[model samples]
Target: MNSIISEGVQVSVETFYQPDYSNPVQSEFMFAYRITLENHNAFPVKLHRRNWQIFDSNGSHREVEGEGVVGVQPTIQPGESYQYVSGCNLRTEMGKMKGTYQMENLNNKQMFTVDIPSFEMIVPMKNN
Candidate 1:
């Protein structure tokens, strides 16, 4: 797992390789990632958007930008947290992801960007 804190918000990530969903022969590799977002601020905040940069060992790159995560905009109170799981597909067994979340402070409606720490995804066998 990897974690990063920005402006009182903490983002942690855990990755897993989905062998069953991948076909190496076809150059398809699947990976799942779980994210935990924690707010340590004095006010509540809502996650409004997300942006990601995905890189594969084969030199493929992907940029993903969307509203909210997993289809819902969640409001997290001070000292509270939210978690979600998402997946990605890569053309190689090794890859990495990193990004940011756009959040709005409910107290003053001010927006801020929280860093999502970079994490790598590699097949277990590849680690050998």
Candidate 2:
């Protein structure tokens, strides 16, 4: 839960999740996450795309590379935060996700990277 800015733009990430215990046969796993980005500089910033590496409980892995999140590239003004609710489905019971965001500062004409911290997706051992 830590973030920093190189030139004035800041990025922060938080991950949340919910499990489907009743419809196990559906082979569906649900996840939720919120991404917050703040522009500290005088320029505006844009989040262009995402690259994710998802790891399951069985030592298996999956890659999800996509353009933007939820089909829209977000632009944030200075002192403002861009937040979104996004998710995925897993065939397995538990896993974790981590990735990076490609962002650009419009006013500076510079591009920088943002790290999306890895978060857990699981059904607690006590419940299992």
Candidate 3:
């Protein structure tokens, strides 16, 4: 259970590798992930953008920045939890990613970051 606190919001992740759909010998891996964002603050907030630093097993690192995950910026109230499932592709069979969500506190004119905990992605060998 990897969780990080960003602007009072706790974000955690669980990754599932799709080895049946990957070609590890060719350095192609597929993984699906579920991220949970819990607003443990007393105020409400909305996720605006994504900023991440991803490091692959091959010593390659990439920075991905984007707005509105899955094309929607949903507002989550206080004590609420938001979850989304997404997928990503990597050139290696394993890697680690950590990032923060740019969030806006609707209650006040303040913007804060919600930390995303470092999570691992691994494509387990498919059993015959």
Candidate 4:
């Protein structure tokens, strides 16, 4: 797991390779990642959008931008957290992902960007 704190918000990530969904013979690899967002500010924050940068060992890259995470904008209160699991498909067995979340402070309507720590996705066997 990897974690980072940005603008009073903490983002943690854990990644796993899904062998069942991957077809190495065809150069397709699937990975699932769990992200935990923690609000440390005194006010509540609502996630508005998400932007991700994905990289594969084969020199392939993808950028994904969308409204909210997993299809919903979640409000997280101080000392509270929101967690979700999402998947990514890559052309290689090794890859990485990093991104940011656009959040708004419900109390003051202040918008800020929260960094989602970069994490690696590698087949378990590759760790050796």
> The CA-based lDDT of model 1 is what?
0.96
Q: In model 2, which regions exceed 4 Å deviation?
A: 1-10, 14-16, 19-22, 124-128
**Candidate 1 collision pairs:** none
Q: What's the lDDT of the predicted structure labeled candidate 4?
A: 0.95
Which stretches of model 3 miss by more than 4 angstroms?
A: 126-128
Best by lDDT: 1
Cα lDDT computed for each candidate against the true fold = 0.96, 0.73, 0.85, 0.95
Error of 2 at 69 (Å): 1.0
Model 1 Cα lDDT, one tens digit per residue, 7-95: 89999999999999999999999999999999999999999999999999989899999999999999999999999999999999899
Work out how many backbone clashes candidate 1 has. 0
* Backbone clash numbers for all candidates listed: 0, 0, 2, 0
Q: Model 4 residue 51 lDDT?
A: 98
- TM of each candidate vs. truth: 0.98, 0.78, 0.91, 0.98
Model 1: CA > 4 A from native: none
If the candidates were sorted by their lDDT against the true structure, best first, what order would they fall in? 1, 4, 3, 2
